[model samples]
Target: MFCGGYQVQGTIFLNPNCDPMMDAQLIGGALQGFGCDKDVLIDILTQRSSAQRIMIAEAYGSLYGRNLLEDLRENLDGHFKEVMVGLMYSPPAYDAHELWHAMKGAGTDENCLIDILASRTTSDIFQLKEVYLMQYGNNLDQDIYSETSGHFRDALINLAQGVREEGYADPGMAAQDAMVLWEACQRRTGEHKNMMQMMLCNKSHQQLWMVFQEFQNISGQDIATAIEECYDGYFQQLLLAIVSCVRDKPSYFAYRLYSAIHDFGFHNKTIIRTIVARSEIDLFTIRQRYKERYGKSLFHDLKNFASGHYEKALLAICASDGQDF
Candidate 1:
């Protein structure tokens, strides 16, 4: 159920009984009243798949002669608006916007950069780059290079190339790669960074899994532990993200969701981004993983952490899995 490291199981799917014009009519009514009917917005937008949402957007413009996203911006505000607008974009377009937001302005959001680049598949990255260029009028890789420096920048650029090996993994090569990684960790020299980066960034996820297993056998520690011991700063974080996604992408994202909710006063952007981005991909899997890893359903945690229309919209996208709110 996985394609190129992305799980095919998604909470949101194409609505079999879809009527774009009717849905657009309801959405237009929701936008027309004195106070926007956020309930209607949540119900209509959250229930439709991304492709369906696009159709609805087209229908809205045809019926109302107004852009859906711009209307949402004019009518809605705050994090709720962010979520609504985010749902309007295709996955790659959304990712491109997120990347541009992360890199632009006074400081870089290293975590955002790491989360997106490390998690996307090669095809996703390629589409994202193309969209970024068309939308932002700049190259994503060049922008990332300019925003970052040293080993971290090099690693990000390497990932941005979107040329990681795919489809086949050799046990023999995995063992060799593992040994090379172990030796790099032991050496802890400038050259060691290159060695680790090459192996981690270039190998397919399946091959990396084998390499990680071989690494555990060769050394008494996991690859993550080895990376932690040898490196520090954003460079270390990016490597760990790659390994984490390779091992179990859903689990990695589940942990990210947990941290976003608990690590601070509510890292709402990360919360919204993770849920909305994965909703149509593997959010159901992420939700299951969240409960398994954290001993509580994602819906339960979000209900506790958030309130009002924002919470309702997020829960709607999360969909139901027999979890009582």
Candidate 2:
């Protein structure tokens, strides 16, 4: 089953039988009576399921008279802190936090915006909006409006509304939408921006995947290729993100991990966010896809890019067996 863009098989399922109170005690002990036991923090936080983590948080608060999140924040520093805290948040809250940060800076992080907003389902967006509001005290759509503009802004706004079509896809409608996409993108000298955005934003992922197939058959061009040819800048990026997410989100995120890790500059923020966000969702499948496509272990690459506590923490979460890497 698809949880928005993430596949169920892609998730890391651990802590099947767990004691949250015991976990809370252990975690509390790790944080106290030492100069912050990094190993214990890495092991416990990264091994447990997200649900278990929530329980641990509650137990930690009751047991220690301190919030688990605040204790982790004080004990850990740098990227290690980031990954641990990210794991503690519910999925929607995490996404909201990410979006808030993306738009908080002087210049908007278009890639972050596109990566998140375009790929999520209507239901995912609805949940995200609620969390975003609670976390940031601003509407998600209004934040988008403030941070972005033009066709790209419009697409983001449409996605933020969380009003996309859901349920079974119609083959006939898929074909018709494909033609509509082709005409909007390929035939005209100047692309029909409104029509393209409307259809792409409105259609369900199932329908969009079929539309992409029909588009490939009709235009002899993959949807991403066509979008690349017709549009430029953030608009093209968003369109490609939508198509990629619809067709294969794991592959899409796998490529993202590859780019972030392989580059000299090393998009650390993107790397940390992607791994932490997708850890419970599809990081395993992403790891498999990454290995298959790149002919290297993501774990090996991770070591090259990060080190010490940060590397240890990241590898712990990423390990297939939920062991420290």
Candidate 3:
């Protein structure tokens, strides 16, 4: 999601509600500010959608607002800079490619690979793979295999392939996949752990939800129990989060915000990146759904779960209700 919604709907919606003309003016104003301010950049570009960023880029020349890309070139640094600049100029696909390049060859930059690959939508990953090959002359899986090792590599590769298409899958076929998942979970079988990793990262929320529902009914045990029975560490938590999210997404964010604050003991950089990426899109609905389901707002939960500046930023994002049109 974009910059999490703010305290005021008036500021977020304004008159234009992402009016490109207004976006153009805002970009110029920021670029021409007293000096390059990162706070300004994060404040403006982080909040605006890609279409608005494009308009600002296009109008920059006429307005002499400093070419958006050039300004970013001058101002930003490191991985955030790369992701933001790529997002500013092109679609999300190229940023995924940038992430791939950072990881591929030699020792493999696991951090970069996980950062982009872990949180993307299936369609986004699909498009990323297509563009990655076009840009790099190699497949994503091949590059991953070259860099990674063991079951972790295998699992990561499967996920990067985007094999779990979310829609129009035959329920019959999906039942079979669910059976495979369930049997893997059976303590007698011992296939549960590896399968857990595969499912958690690979399955889409919709496809996996079907699997989760049937597995619980058929196995007579809930999905969380199955996951707890099978896996551990961040991956287990991720699977649990997935199941929780399928039941209700806002609950998932609440859990995540809680884990970030109280459970994990801090705002992990990975969680931060993931939340920032998502807050622009699904987060608004997640907040609404959280309120509807929990009878307490997502923002309120963050206030309880987190503290300090971290709390302030996340709470602001929650209040903004990032999903609003």
Candidate 4:
């Protein structure tokens, strides 16, 4: 989730000898109350990794002869319900579901699309594309093509191809790529969108980091700043996301989390999706980055911005100290 294991410090981890039936009972006992044991629910759900949660779900269903996810939805409410259910899905499956939600809505969520596509690694994208096809019986590429248009659509298609060049980077080539990027944005204007997109999307993170540095050396402006000055609209946002992910993904997601739920009329769905999706990944680093940047705890902010089970669920996931709940 944060630069292909470049940042391995995360909030969630495998609980040793995690027993699924024990988890089932813990959850079952929690739900066996008049008011739904919110604390117990948060404790159980937030502490387990995704694999453990899946096993717990299976155990719960087998024990009670009821679908665990359905029961979760029936028992929980609002943004909390979405978070719990989203946590139940496997990572690739959950990402595919998020992409489907983004494109299926009345107006496409271009931010969600760009966020998922631009931030993911080549291998992750490959797995997500496969999951999307198997789960929905539709090609991810075709769905993206139909849902979007113009240079942004073309850029997304390139990303969905899952064809990034990986492994060691050539420094000389990185410098050349940087020069080409500078020329495209500065001298030639928007005449080389495809070249820029290909370089941004296809190169390995190590390669792009070099290219971005050289780009700044040559142009006297960061790649993101140059892209902002030269490009506009969805394409510019996509390019910026790519640059941000390559540079510092945890910080990027921290900022994204802030935007999703910070303002008046917050998007709780985005909050649920992002926090749930990232909980088992680099959410720990993201939380630290958020606190450093915003001068307050992410948990405190979520508690203020949201209410009821939703706030509790998010705090459980955020888990200020990055320890198991």
lDDT, each prediction: 0.90, 0.84, 0.58, 0.84
TM-score of each: 0.96, 0.93, 0.66, 0.92
List, residue by residue over 1-325, the lDDT tens digit for candidate 3.
3211222111122224565556556656655646544444555555665566677677765666457787766665554454456546445654455566567555555655654565555777888888888877888888878777755566667677776655533566566777877777765233555666677666666676677777877888887897787766544554565466446554555455545545556554444444455554565655555566667665665566555545544444444534322
Instruction: Give, for candidate 1, the lowest lDDT window spanning 10 residues.
Output: 316-325
Candidate 1 lDDT, 198-266, residue by residue in tens: 888889998999999999999989999999989999999999999999888888899999999999778
Candidate 2 all-Cα RMSD:
2.4
Q: Give stretches of model 4 more than 4 Å off.
A: 1-6, 29-35, 187-191, 320-325
Candidate whose TM-score is highest: 1
Q: Which of the two candidates, 1 or 4, achieves a greater TM-score against the reference?
A: 1
Cα lDDT tens digits for candidate 4, 114-163: 98998887888999999999989989999999999988998999999988
lDDT comparing candidate 1 with the true structure: 0.90
Among the numbered candidates, top lDDT falls to 1
Clashes of each: 0, 0, 11, 0
* Candidate 3 residue spans exceeding 4 A from truth: 1-29, 32-34, 37-47, 61-67, 76-119, 131-139, 146-148, 169-178, 187-207, 233-250, 289-325
What lDDT score goes with residue 41 in model 3? 53
Roughly what TM-score does model 3 have, to 2 decimal places?
0.66
